[model samples]
Target: MPSHRAAGLVAGLLWLASLWLPAISLAARHADMDLQAFEQNGWWLLTAGWVGIFSGQPAWLANLLVIGLVPTLLMGKQPPWWVSLACAALSLLSLALPGTTIHFDGGPYRVVAFDIGYWLWLLAAQIPALLMLTELNVRRRAK
Candidate 1:
């Protein structure tokens, strides 16, 4: 069996992998819309902040890149509580973002539904925080 730290590290790595997959897809509802709209439209966690179509780079403010991707690169090092909390909070907030809304050129707006990527991103981003809480709980009981 793996130690708690090892398990956490594995979980963190898996979480990071999810960030690289497509985070969203844009689709056009009518023929008047651009056909490219259906293409996978999103950046992985690494470039999620700079790439993609959003107002003022909203992803930078709430992205797994900062929390999930970065920390996972550190290997098995346990992240501080603040880091976990921030990651969890930001990931959750991203879910609330209007990612489905797609703007058109001199046409009506098209809203695309979130694909599996969005849901996976949300779940993966929260792993660190959940692991942190579990660790804290275990430590408390051991005391």
Candidate 2:
């Protein structure tokens, strides 16, 4: 078990766990609508094939991508670099896109912030990317 492979396993597990955590937290200016309401409305992390609280189609796609990539990440030894790159790119895109936007009927608006899940997912994606790059460089050097 190489260090990079171990790291990938840990990161991949973290990423899987993150899917259950809140991807985003919401705060509204109006007291009438609070975090609980949004949460109840399904604004938490996606699990069991259900979308996150604020997550839309993109979120589902992101999850599927991660899920699809995690196995490759676990393979570790001589894993395809392209898969890692794709996962990294998808993670970056997911991080950049705002999960969902909720508007209240008031003068003020809602404030949304990235949560633990987002950071963990991003880290998980990067772990494989970095490892694959390093492995490729090491192999090239040896040759």
Top model number, lDDT: 2
Taking all chains together, each candidate's TM-score versus the true structure is 0.61, 0.64
How does model 1 fare in lDDT?
0.55
Give residue 106's error in model 1 in angstroms.
Answer: 8.8
Which candidate should be chosen as best, given TM-score against the real structure? 2
- Weakest 10 consecutive residues of candidate 2 by summed lDDT: 35-44
lDDT of 2 by residue, 23-122 (tens): 6665554466544423211124454224332444343444555565566555655456676677677667555444344444444323366667677777
Pick out the ten consecutive residues of candidate 1 with the lowest summed lDDT. 44-53
**lDDT (CA) per prediction:** 0.55, 0.58
Residue 55: error of model 1 in Å?
A: 3.4
Per-residue lDDT over 47-133 for candidate 1, one digit per residue giving the tens place of the 0 to 100 score = 534443355434445453444444453565666678777766766755544444545445433335556566666665666677778
How many clashes does each candidate structure show, in the order listed?
A: 0, 4
